[model samples]
Every structure is written in structure tokens, then in C-alpha cells.
Target chain A: MKKIAKMVCILVVSLVPTLGHGAFQAIGIIKSVEGEVYLISSSTEIQAVSNMKLISGDNIITGNDGSVGLIFKDDTVVSLGPNSQIEVQDFVFNPAEEKLSFAARLVRGTFSFITGQIAKLAPKKVKLTTPDATLGVRGTKFVVEVK
Target chain B: MNRSLRVLSFLILSSIVTVLTYSGCSKTTVVLLKDPEGKVGHLVVENEAGSVDITKENEATTIAGATSKPAAPKRYSEDKISSQFGEALNMLPTQPKHFILYFKSGSTELTDSSKAQIPDILKTIELRSSEDISVVGHTDTAGNSAYNMRLSQRRASVVRKLLIGEGVRADHIQSTSHGEANPLVKTADNVNEPKNRRVEVVVR
Candidate 1:
């Protein structure tokens, strides 16, 4: 009986490594709150169970009723009004020197952006392609509304 | 009278004179003198209220009871891009080139074998395209969250400089460190997982 108990403990210990490997990647943080997700940045409240895919330099905020805002590393800040779905398809950032690259897809929502160093360093590098028109920014601020 | 008292009286008299002068002038005369260059001598309509100032600029036109009209909106055609450039952009990779650099336990530095891939990756980007590139550094959960975040960004910047040195335009690439925000395997802290330390590339 003693031998059997020891063997069982060893088996459980071996399986522990495999069991602890499932966690969601954090892309952003929840900044503030409004009727919906109002403000988002590096400093915001994020629930561990939210399962939102967050990358470095991602700022995401969700409201009680399901509004969201997403800010990316490229200094591209997006505010979602309500019941919107936005995904940060890709993002890259270097904090020490302030370099960044980001790409996001707005499936259905209203969003706004403030261009970051990526747009300033290489204006052509940042591209926001929408259904109607593709927006290319050369260090400018603009808003977009999509249905 | 004392000097101060006299000065005060003079100021009061001047105020009275200025008020009388303004009141004596007709509204039209006041409008004319105020707009010597006639730059502001135009009719303004707000909501239902409308006012017309017949100054020197509009006086040249001999039409009686002429009202100002809102400027016409200029029509603009869409700016077209050359097909050659458009085609080139379309052929580029839509997704970023991802490289997962596994690190030792509690370490942010790249492993020996992983460092070897950096030069080749930089060369490929330099030779293939002239567009901008992006490099993002990531880390696994091995240490404090704040420290991991900074480490990740530093790693990404290292890769960005390497690419720039290999003839890729420095202005064409940007880098960001995404600390431990996006982990490949979301396990508990101090896991020292290899999949976590990675720098991803996207060429646009």
C-alpha cells in the first residue's frame, strides 16, 4: 500500500507540467470607463478571465455592457463605442527607444486613432485598410466609423 | 486740483466723449470706418439673422440688394496610385514573419542557436523589399511582470538594429516590446518556457 501511494504521487507530479500551460496572451490593459469601454492604455484594469488577446503596448478596456477600446504599440489609439469587435492582428514595440509597428482589423465598430512613432518614422509603413478606403497616415490624427 | 484728481477727471471726460462719439455715428458709418480695408465688410447670415455691410469691396459691384452667397464646395477626384506600386504592395506578405526565440529559465537573452537566425532574417528583409518592417519582442513568464515587459522591448530593439544594419532602411522599420502580454503558453510564473521569448517581424 505504501509503495502504491508513492507511485501515485510521482505520476501526479509528472502531469502537473502539462496541466499548467494554458493562459491567454495579454495584448492591452483597460484604462478607464464610460457607458462602454471608454479609455484604454498600458495602465488599466484587466480581468484575468477576460481572455482578451493582449500584446505589448496594447490598451484595451471593456465596459459592463460590452463596449471596448483598443490602443496599439504604433501609437494607434482606437476607441470602440459599443458592441464592437476589434482585433490586434499584430504588434511590435521597443520601449527604450520608442519604436513600434502594429496592425489591427476592425471587424464591426466605430474607432479612432492617434498616430505613433511608426507613422512618423515611416509614414507608408502604417496602413489602415477599410472596406471603402485605405487610409495612409503621415503623422496625422483621424477617425474611422465602420458598420 | 491735485495732479491725481485732475488725471482722474480727464479720464472720466475722455470716456464720456468716446461714448458720445460712438453713439453719434450711424451703424453703417461705424461699420465703414471700422473696416478700412473692407476685409470685414461682408454680409453675415447666422440662422435667421442677417446683416449687410456695404463697404468698399462690395461697392464695386453695381447690383442692387446683392446678397453674399456661401462659397461653393470644391470637387475632388480620388488620387490614383500607379498600378506598379500597388501590385508590388499586394504581393508582399500580409502576415508578419514570426520567430520564436526560446530562452533559458528566468532569462531574456536569446539562446546560442536562436541568435544564429538573426542575420539571415535581416538579410532576407533587406534584399526582398524596400518597404517598412516591424519587430516585436516578447517574453515568457519567468520573472516579475514589469521586468519581463522591459526585457521584451529591449530584445525587439536589438533585432530591429540588426535588420537596419543589414541594409534594411532604418526609417523603414519600427520596434516595440510587448513584455509578457502575449505569451504562447500561458502557464504560471517562472515557467522558463521557450515559446515565450520571441521577436516577430512584419514587412509592409
Candidate 2:
């Protein structure tokens, strides 16, 4: 009976589309791309294109003459200048369960960020990390340059 | 001999100044910028040594390393910011737009004024190269939550259909119902709020 119950539980879990949160879902969309921008995901790198869906753990790299812009599901706007790179470290914007967070790392380049609902809902949840220091955003727009 | 020594000392001092300037340029910099609406926000730069708070627009700070504190905040001129961040700024995407359309109490029918905004909404969508639209339905707190949920769903569907009829791609639109859970105006249970009974369409 216990084995049968375990099998039934597994079947029910598989039947549901979502597992209570937006896991493995596209968290943002690339709005614009100029020049030679590349997106690296799951160890595969491809040329970045406008309107491409972005998931967590993705890295965006721009060539010397490339630039890109993206908007998260929570309306957070981020843009990169030429020769810049950034990683989407963590993103969770499930307002229903009050799970709101945004984090990114700027490896080496110029980046502009505009906070969104996640920062408005929770001031301390948004963070941007650079090679030298970490930034705690308090609902604002800012730019960073890592030499 | 004394004159030659003085000239040698001067050369050493200028070289030291050049070295310091080069190191300063290598430090990472963070600059706060004004939003499109001209509002400024705050930022906190922290490291192992200490933290610096940036409150004013155009304020900036530099960090040398992970173990060093951020430099004191200093405001930058508009010209300097533009020169350094022009590429990033130009690449920024347009902010998402939102429109609220009110409904006739407890019904999916849109009010006269709300119905009139459909053309404007469609025009905005047409201007964008790629459109991702969302139509969410909401209701007042007058009825039971379960019934209100279904009503809100119907309201969203009605608006979605209208947009589709106006030549909007059906795939670009997504409809959802928040019921009485999310309200525009806070109200007691079983209270009627015309402002609360509405559908919000977001164009991105």
C-alpha cells in the first residue's frame, strides 16, 4: 500500500504544470541588440537577438562594438555597453507568494540598471555585484563601470 | 650640482603623481542616475572595510578592492556622465506602459470612457516592433471571492477578445484574473468600489 501511494503522489505531481513557483520559466526578454552580442546559457553560446527570452543562469557578453538591453518580468531594465558582460544570477518575481528577488553580477564592463517592482516591494532584495564591491539598491537607477 | 639635484627631485615627484592617477582610474566606479521621470533614488556601496551611501542624483563612488571601503560620494557633471555612459543609456529599453479600464459594476462591460481608450492602446502596440501584451481582470469586494474570480476571468476574456478583433495578434496577448485579491482601492469586505472593478492592460 505504501508503494502504491508513493506512485500515486508522483503521478499527481507530474500532472501539474507548475510546481508552486516559476521555476525554469523565462524570467525576462531581450529588448534590443547591436553589433556582436552573444548569450551563453547552459555552456552553449549563441548570437544574441532581439526578443529572445532570458532565463536565470544566463550570461550576456558584448563585443568591443556591441551593446544590448533587456527587461525582466518585474519590469527591471538593464542595459550593457560595448565590451561588457553580466550574469543573471537569481530572479524570482512570484508576487502571489511574496517571493521577489533580483540579483546580477557585472563581470567587467559598463552597465545601467533601473529597479522595478521587486525593489519597490522589498528594498533590500535587489543586489548588483561587481568585481570590487556589491551594491544594495534602494529603488533607483544607477550605472556601474568595472575597469 | 645643487641645481641638478633640484631638477631630479622635481622629475621624481611628477612621476609619482602620474602613477597615482593611473591607479585611481583602475578603481571600479558606481554612479547614481536620475530616472526617466526625473526622480532620484538611493544606493549603498559596501565592502569588507565599510559602506558608502549615495543619495543624490549623479552622485558617484569608487571602490579599489573587496577589502577596501568605497570612496566618499561625489556628484558628477551631466557632461561627464553622458560621455561615460552614452552607450549604455542609449541601449536602455523603453519602460513598459500600463492602462486601466474600468467596468460597469460586477459586469464585463466597459464604461464609456474606458471603451474609448481602445484605439489609443492599439496605436501604442502598433508603434512597438515586438509587442507582449497582458490583460488582467480585477473586481470589487462586493461578492463572494469564488464567484468574483470567475467574473474577473470573464472580464479579462472580453477585453482580450476586443483587442483581438481590432487586429491584435492573438498570441501576443495573455489574460488572467486577480479577482478581489488585488484591489486598486482598499475597502471593507462586501463593499462596492467602481475603481476596483477594472481590467489593466500592459503593453511591453
Candidate 3:
């Protein structure tokens, strides 16, 4: 059954330019980790670790007994419990310019989210998508479980 | 091949039975979200049942399950937000750490005790291999709303710089100002409250 989880294998060919002068490249950071976890970006799968950087469009997967926590540019905290996979579908934040956006897809497993500065600055811009539903946030703290 | 088709069948069947009649084989994906930052926002939840708007901070909304069109949204209190997702939260690591730092009246300066609290914060951060820190500023009701707004911004900026100076990654930290709107203690207009003149920090 796990074989059905086809990997998109994204090859971030678009070079990430320098910051401040352009769009902010990195959107999140791995704040914590336990057990088995991996980050599938482009066509690569990298083992997860504390402090690992996360960018938009990366698919994160965790094995049994594995959990990972992440923090975005807006201080939004999202932690994934064991045997789960989630994707950072979209993220955009530029306070000086008043531009903000956040969207994610929790494919399976459990993950808790605490709204970040992006939601507080722009609530309408925050959203979380699931297999059967789409969630809009108002600077909140809540968890999602997909069975 | 059979396994993948079975999974696909499950998805198709779930959608087909998503109407008024629900089947026992369907998978229910539950979603809960609460806004504890006290930011008043109109959040939209769209699904098979219809759509509902979410407003007010500390308030929460939940969708019972989704292998089909999800059930109608349900709202809950702040404390109930986590408990409502108890099954999911139980699988997570220890709860995130929260810290409250007090400020002087009408000033961005940290109080004596709060200043002392910085060391513990720094130590805790050092212990973690990875970190995302949030520093939010707030003010009491002693000044005009506009004035307090700017004051809160100044306070958050002051603390953000402090953390950055202490070696926290600048990009990983988020700083915000809530003015007098989100007070720890409710107070009448023009009333001063020490607890309200503070900063809230969360380390995840």
C-alpha cells in the first residue's frame, strides 16, 4: 500500500537567488525530530534532523515512532506524529511589503499547527488542505489526524 | 498493483457515498484549528456539507471526518482545542514551550525578573538542536490604541534584536505586536495592568 505514495521527485531547477533583493527562499526550519523522518524534495529524499531547513513544496514523511516539528517564517508551528506524510504546498511571507500566504496538505497521520505571524498578519491567506477537506485558519492552534 | 487499486477504490467509494448516507468502511480525516493569538479573522471552511466562516481568536473549529464530504464544522473554546484533537496530539512530542516577559510601564525595557528569565530561555534554546522562536508584543490599556500599537511594535522589535544578538537565527524567529487588544488580564479603558505590558515568546 505504501508503494502507491508516488514520489513527485521535484528537481528545483529554478536557482534560489540571493535574499532581501529577491523573494525569501527558505520558508521553514525543522525545530525537532524523533524516530524516523525524511524530506522528499524534487527527486531526492533526505533524512530529517533538528535544524534542517524546509522549503515550500517539500513532502515530509515519518516512519513508525517518528515525529518531526517545523516552524515557518511567520512563527507558525507544525509538528507531525509517527507514520505520517505532509507537504508544504505553498508559503509566502514578506512583512515589509505586507505579502503573506500559507497552504499545506496533510496527506496522512497526525500533525498539530499553531498559527504563525503570517496568519496574524493575514488570516485569509492561511489555509490547510486535506484528502476530504480544506481548512482556513484565523491565527489558531489545532491538530489534524488523517486515518 | 492490486494494493494501489484497492486504495484508489477506497477513495472513489468514499466520494460516492459522501452524500447523506455514510458507510462504515470510509476513512474520516479530522481537522481542528484554533486562533490563540487573538487576531479577529474570518476563516472559511468549504466542504461537501457547505461552508462556515471562523472569526474571533481563542475560538476553534473542527470537521469530524473526511473519507467523504466532511461533516459540518464545529466550534470550541481555547482549552478544548487541543483536547478535541486528543488522539492526534497524543502522538506528538512534548508540548511547545511558552514564556511571558514583562515590560516596564510605557517602556520597552524588560523587568528585573524577566531579565533574569532570559538566561533560562537561552539555555533551553541551546539544548535544542533545532528551534523556531516567536516573540509577540502586547501593551496595557494605559495609552491610546494607536500609541499602544506602536509601543507594542517597539517592544517586539527590541526583543527580536536581543534574541538575534544571542545567536538565534534571524530568519527562524518571528516578531509581532498585538497592541492592547490581547491582554492577559481584562481591564477597562485607560487602566494600567502590569501583566498586559509584556511579550509572549514560544519556542517550538
State the lDDT at A93 in candidate 2: 74
Ranked candidates, highest TM-score first:
2, 3, 1
**Model 1 Cα lDDT, one tens digit per residue, A1-147:** 754444433222211111111233333333223454422334565442221335543434334354443334333444554444455545544322333456665444444444544564445555554332234445333333444
Model 2: per-residue Cα lDDT over B30-73, one tens digit each: 99989988999999999777899999999999998666689999
What lDDT score is found at residue A138 in candidate 1?
Answer: 52
Local accuracy of candidate 1 as per-residue lDDT tens digits, B29-57: 10111122223222221111223223332
Residue-level lDDT of model 3, residues B22-135, one tens digit each, is: 334224344444335443445566667666565544433445444344454455555564554543454444335668899999999999999898877777777753356777
Looking only at chain B, model 3 earns a TM-score of 0.57
Best by DockQ: 2
Quote each prediction's TM-score. Answer: 0.33, 0.84, 0.56
- Comparing 2 with 3 on lDDT, the higher-scoring candidate is 2
lDDT of 3 by residue, A56-99 (tens): 78999999878787766566777887888898888877553445
The two-chain DockQ for each candidate, comma-separated, is 0.02, 0.31, 0.20
Under CAPRI classification, how is model 2 graded?
A: acceptable
DockQ, cand. 1: 0.02
- The positional error of residue B53 in candidate 1, measured at the CA in angstroms, is 67
| TM-score for candidate 1, residues paired by index | 0.33
Question: Better model by lDDT, 1 or 2?
Answer: 2
Per-candidate TM-score, first chain only? 0.54, 0.84, 0.82
